[model samples]
Target: MDMLFSLMSPQVFLLSCMVALLAGVIKGMVGFAMPMILISGLSSLISPELALAGLILPTVLTNGWQALRQGHAAAWGSVKRFRVFLLVGLVALLISAQLVRVIPHWVMLLLIGGPVSVFSIIQLLGWQFRLPERGHGWVEAGIGGFAGFLGGMSGVWGPPTVLYLTALDTAKTEQMRIQGVIYGLGAVALFGAHIGSGVVRAETLPFSVALLVPALAGTWLGFQIQDRIDQVAFKKATLLILLIAALNLVRRALIG
Candidate 1:
């Protein structure tokens, strides 16, 4: 309790928990964006490093839940199918994860905010990004590397991953499962990477752990809504909200 309070006041801590819950709910409904939401929201209340730390364990656990929701075999199949992306992404993530320790906060925010805003705007424009029907190995590796670089630094790689999946015209269910598998693995890499980077150390770890309950609960609620709602409608709305949040991040990066 003493350690947690040192990070934030009681009211601020409660707000951070709300952010986690909101992030989880969005993740459940759309199959991605939890890290974006967590980072964008929590960074408002705490230092980016602490916010990053706060998200680490919840990201790992929630993505694990998402990946295994369909069972191990399906998750393994996704791993096999996207092996190139996974391998490249993990390597890039490992390399770039170290940057967080030295990168300026505003630069980090801009890096996250810029790409996310573009992604959200492009998605909102109804432009269906497409790829050829043939070999995608090189493309996979490229986007994977980029996503991993961002993920390592900011705990965000969803925009590019979603774009790649969208380009493939992947099925909704398969896309969701693949997202779970990919992000789950990425989150695990992030966990290990940040641990080595000293972002997820003793003082910050408990706050991350404390957030798990609300995250889980909100994800469960989102799952229920996901089953019944018009997903396209819901996704569009979510993107709009993301656009707002993303632009706010950009604003902070530039002016604040």
Candidate 2:
């Protein structure tokens, strides 16, 4: 209450909660984009640093639920299957996170947003791509590195990860679980990295904690919707959302 108000006014707080709920719902349905939505929406109402801090806990917790929804065993399987990606991404994320204050925001946004938007548009136009049947390790490492680099700077890594998964033609349930595993681990690293970067401190901690209620509630609702959708519908929904998210990133870069 007092702590949350300290971060933003009551009206802003209300709007921020609404954004969190929306972000959570989308995350639940498609298994990504919470950070992009949170940073974009909350940054409009609050400082970017505070917005980054505010998203930390909710992203962490929601991703935890997403990762475990299928069971621990399945989540572990995803971890093992994508160990190279996870290792490279986490390492890159930790290293790039330290550069957050050094890099220009627009540069990072444009670099990630443009390619992702193009990729999504191509996919939506019925042009599909798949990873090579042999020797994909290098490809996974490259995409993971790119995702981690963007994630460390902006807290938005879903686009590239989603791109990689889509290229693999991953099944819906598996894709959801894999995203949770990837993002959940990455979120933990982000929490740690930002704490060291002084983005998440005592002052911003409460604001992050306060959003958990609405975020969780929205994710539960999204899960209900997700359960009702078939694989084709899920893929379409994911791509559409990805396209919108990518375009929003581009818009922010251009507008800012």
Candidate 3:
């Protein structure tokens, strides 16, 4: 708590809690967008470095929980199914993550915001892309690589991953489980990559740890809401909200 208090003022702490809570609920209901929400929301209130650091623990926690929601056997099944995508994404994420320390902040924001906006809009427009079965291998690799680069730079890989899955026309149940697996594994890679890159340092660790409570609580509450809502409507609304967040990120980068 002392470490948390030292890293930012009380106002910022409250902001972080709210951001984490919102991100968590979306993630639990939708199985994506948590990191995007966290990064997009937090960057406006704090430095990108601190924002990334502060999200590490929360991301790891939420993903792990989401991934295991269907039980360990199902999670492991997803891991096996998407093994190549996971490995390539993890490797790319680890390598590109170090760039965070070098790349300009505006560029990072665009990296997070641009793809998110474009991809979400594409989905909203009812576009369903299809890859030939023969091309699935390279396509998966490509998507994973792009997602890894985005994740490394801004701690967000959900948009591209979601688009890829939807393009495959994966069933809703499996899509949710797969998303959990990919996100959980990505979160693990995020924790490790940032720790090595020095984004998740001693001074920043406390902030991340403190966010775990709100993150889990919000996710649990979101699951309750998910059961009663019209999923199609909720999804459309979520995409609209994400679009706004993405535009906000772009605006911040441009104005700054």
Q: Is candidate 1 or candidate 3 better by TM-score?
A: 1
Q: Each candidate: what lDDT?
A: 0.85, 0.91, 0.82
In candidate 3, position 144 carries an lDDT of 93
Return the TM-score for candidate 2, rounded to 2 decimals: 0.98
lDDT of 1 by residue, 1-256 (tens): 8999987899999999999999888888877888888888898889889999998888888888888888999999999999999999999999999998788878977876787789879888987668874687899999999999989998888777877886777766677789989998999999999999999998999999999988888888877766676657656755676677678779988997
Clashing pairs in 1: none
TM-score on alpha carbons, each prediction:
0.93, 0.98, 0.92
lDDT of candidate model 2 versus the reference? 0.91
Instruction: Name the better of 2 and 3 by lDDT.
Output: 2
Number of backbone-clashing residue pairs for each candidate, in the order shown: 0, 0, 0
Model 1 is weakest, by summed lDDT over 10 consecutive residues, at 229-238
RMSD of 2: 1.0
Q: Score candidate 3 by lDDT.
A: 0.82
Per-residue lDDT, model 1, residue 60, is: 83
Total backbone collisions, model 3: 0
lDDT digits (tens) for residues 92-191 of candidate 3: 9998899988988888777767877887788789875676644588889998999988889888888778777766766556777898889888988889
Q: How do these models rank on lDDT, best leading? A: 2, 1, 3
